[model samples]
Target: MEMIEMNTRERRRMTLMTRVAEGLLKLRMAAEMLVVSYRQAKRIWRRYREEGDVGLVRRGRGRSSNRTRPAAERKRAVALYVKQYGGFGPLLASEHLASDHGIKVDHETLRRWLLSAGLWASRRRREAHRAARERRPRRGDLVQIDGSEHDWFEGRGPRVVLMVMIDDATNKTLARFYEGEDTAAAYDIFDRYVCQEGLPVALYPDRDSIYVCTREACLEEELANVGPETQFARAMRELGVGLILAHSPQAKGRVERRHGLFQDRLVKEMRLLGIRTLVAANAYLDGTFLALVNARYTVKARDPTNGHQTRPTTATLALVLSWQEPRTVAKDWTLCWRNHRLQIDARHAALGLPGRRVVVAERRNGTLAILHNKRLLTFRNAPAPAAPRLRPAAPQAPHLTRRPPAADHPWRRSALIHRPVFCPPPTSYTAHSRGAENRAAATPSRAVPTT
Candidate 1:
């Protein structure tokens, strides 16, 4: 007797065939129970009767799938991945394999191979329960912007921040590398996005101080019924673009999720290409990486109409997307900013700039412009005021000489032991009596009785 292995389905079919052969069930009834055609059931019954239990098993059960790649091909893919694409996720690795190495393999298949080869570890995902939010209806309706600071160069260079802007509706992404996440980075990335894709209807960003003013309102601002606005916020308002602040990281889940993806995929891609500087990283981002990401991840918006307005002119954009502050011109036609005095051109002094408010705009290129009545004014760096000169000390009066007393002078003797006493003559008898009593009081032991 030989042992046979069969799945539950196969065992059930075998029992059913035995009953049909014993006349306990009819072929038609068996066919109905098995949910198969009468002809197929007849074939199964015939095979079972002629070949016993062995014939009841499926024919292709233990054989390799016809679509499975050869062992040599699988080995090559795994080797290539370990050598060149290590640390890449299966999906990204498969994409590179197909595009770069001319190896076509499904990501799922590659994932299994990597797991079996111990090149990848399975990750347990803990997805929090949150209500799903639908994407916007048209492209450029809402864009999500955020910065991700990471070791983007993998210790080869200084760590930098990648400022990412992703469209809420289509998932189109724009990104650039900066030294830090600041107003300057925000302006640069937004300026590029607007120029390339036009002005979006609104921007969705986390409540970072770069995007929202976190400072408390001052008394003056409160009394004016106004609140402080960040430079980025002010620029957006001037461009007629709405600014929506996400209360939590989850509120802008799309961009947050994008950060995770880029941290994984973009980091690896940059490492492979040896991108270790901001300029090279940004060049690659603009030229290649962004296009690839958009092509792979972007989807058609529900509505075909573009929600973006036309982009502003270059000069207009530069003026709007700058750090602007209102400064009052002094009597000397000079403006003080950041401890530097900017002397207004004498030509513009004819415009009566004294005691008037003008906007001082610090442009992205580190240039400063003074704007009055929407017109640019020429200015130069005023020389710092000369240090005060020290005055000479006043002449001192001549010192006075002093004379010393003789050693035996009366001033050196004690008055209690060496002083003389004098008595005044009385003017009347009653006065004489008072004086005598006074003398008596002064010399208690010599008191005289008055009768």
Candidate 2:
């Protein structure tokens, strides 16, 4: 009875001694070696001393509580959860789990269970994920990409799409545009990226077709191992840049966040600048708005690789990347862009070959650049004429106001000659009075002789 009744304090000390002196020394030495964690270790030994070996057993081990649920019920609830709300978070899930399915569980508890079953979003994962993303090791490693479709002219003109590429490490917008949302338009963005920002190591973009092409296109190594030959892709291929596709918008959330900022500030900027045409807005975008936006939104780079593979050389870019179709200057020294013939500005005669084929570099924001044999032409904007209005046509006279012919006049109606107002012969031909007319004419001649 005394052995079983060993005091809590003494038993804890004995347990501590057992652990610390397993290889070292006597009980006193062991006790002394129990370190600063001695309070916890001592308490455990004390419990065992008071209640025998049974005290060492867990406090809540054997008997189930009144409020505890059946294992079978939790299993069933998890099944229902996965089927109905596969991707939803736990707090939203718990309400449905309880009210509809009659499974009562705290959200945290449910979260842990779901995690064990591989059904929960990992909070720790999200935290570590954000941290890693926030710490890009190099500036040129990743570029954030997205497309914005809006009426840039605020209903004063056509709606255009703007494809944007911003640096992930520095958050600087390298290029943007006004175009229709299509692969062609996306290539325009890619072209700008090549020229302005140089080749990026990787581009982070949403799963739009431009970023990912079709599945067939992706698996086209056998048929088209040649890589992209489209103007934009060709440039990237030469520079060895890569494209990374995001399955969800949230995956490339940096570009999405930048979009939100642009919506708020860009709209206000347009309003302040009185931008009503695509032309003017694009000018502002390329020039003044750019500097302003970069100043405000560009965060300092997390890594210091400077984000540029190379400052593109005009000579190299010209040789490597083919742009618009080659056109020759006419004898009159005129070049053509779809019928708008241009004169080689006198200042650019330094290019030597007036009749040689030269490449025209058409940019995304509707700007045309002419590169002669080697030198580039500085173009002056051509003045356009104002729209002409149509003149109102002369009024025509009404038909009722015109003069009538003689037959239509009531006064001359009887002059329409009829053959002796001929009366119809009744059912047979009637012999006329030729003899009576001869007798009457003879009587009239005799009367005239007497007169």
Candidate 3:
């Protein structure tokens, strides 16, 4: 006989039926014990007598579920997910499934299916309360900016830094991959953002040295011109854009969150397209990826008014956004840059440029400009000396002949070898020989030889 598995409730009813069959318990009493009606108890008791404990087992036990999906359909979905949407989260994959393949599945159901099939792992989300930050009123009212340094190519190419700016109100994002996150790169990023969306009302960024100068000397200098500002900050000041420095990264959480999203989805997308270089990646972003991301993620602003104002002309923008440094021209009418001397033209003699300080402007497109009092100067490039000239090679040393020693000199004296005054005593052999000689002398010349 096949054994039947029964739950606690079923076993209890079977136990009560056994007592009823033994004639110890009445039918009404068994019904009361099992919490069932008297008629139902009578039927259960009869079935127990005929079929034993098996009759208490549920009839639907060990049977397939009525709402189960077909094996073929499940296998098809799992195969598609593993092949194409492996990195996608469950809800995103479910959306793609319905949109692309007519597979109408609930997100939780698909998540469970993926989990059971070993295609997806569940992530436990942290539940910590943060300070609430309301979005701005207009699209360009406030922009949050940050740089994410990542190995975006996953070893397919060199690692790079991605400069990202997101509108706090509309969630609009502008990003470009760069070699580093420095003042020059930040200036280029702002230049691009301004050309497209005009000047924002304010920019929110971290207190990086590229964005703000924290040095004591720099703070002192800020007393004169822009206060405690870096080169990038000065450019923004010239553009009439306000900046808000975040004390903590969470203060500008919008761009930080977008960085996480890009590191995940953008990396995979670039991998699929074999985009390794920064140029190709940026082009892909401008042409296709940006539109896709904005459409999927952006939201309407609270206020309908556009906060971005009109930008300045291209020439002014270039001048304001460039890297400028003040240098004093040397006696040779040259200024040094990157170890190369920029020689001002002789024609500038009319301007009397020697020993005068001029501002050197380094443009983003790899061009150099020298300006004195806001007037452009013509200059040529030459290799600058690595070190200052030394004294003359020291004066040549005078040579002299050596003099020979005379006969009366100390070298003509007789040399002496000093010896120890006292000799060391000999061992047992020498003492014994002396004693033998004394004994022989005491014995007198017993054997005097004629020779």
Name the top TM-score candidate.
1
Instruction: Summarize candidate 3's per-residue lDDT along 199-224 as a digit string, tens digits.
Output: 89899999898888876556435565
What is each predicted model's overall lDDT from 0 to 1? 0.90, 0.66, 0.85
Judge candidate 3 at residue 71 and give its lDDT.
Answer: 84
1 or 3, greater by lDDT: 1
lDDT of 1 by residue, 93-143 (tens): 999999999999999999999999999999998978999899999999999
The ten-residue window of minimal lDDT in model 2 covers: 124-133
TM-score (C-alpha, index-matched) for candidate 1:
0.81
Q: How does residue 366 of candidate 1 score in lDDT?
A: 78
Error of 2 at 149 (Å): 0.7
TM agreement with the true structure for every prediction: 0.81, 0.40, 0.68
Could you give candidate 2's per-residue lDDT for residues 19-96 as a string of tens digits? 644545444444455543546556655775686566655666567777776789779878887787565568657866
Look at candidate 2 and tell me the lDDT of residue 444: 52
Instruction: Flag regions of model 3 displaced more than 4 Å.
Output: 1-69, 95-106, 218-225, 329-357, 371-451
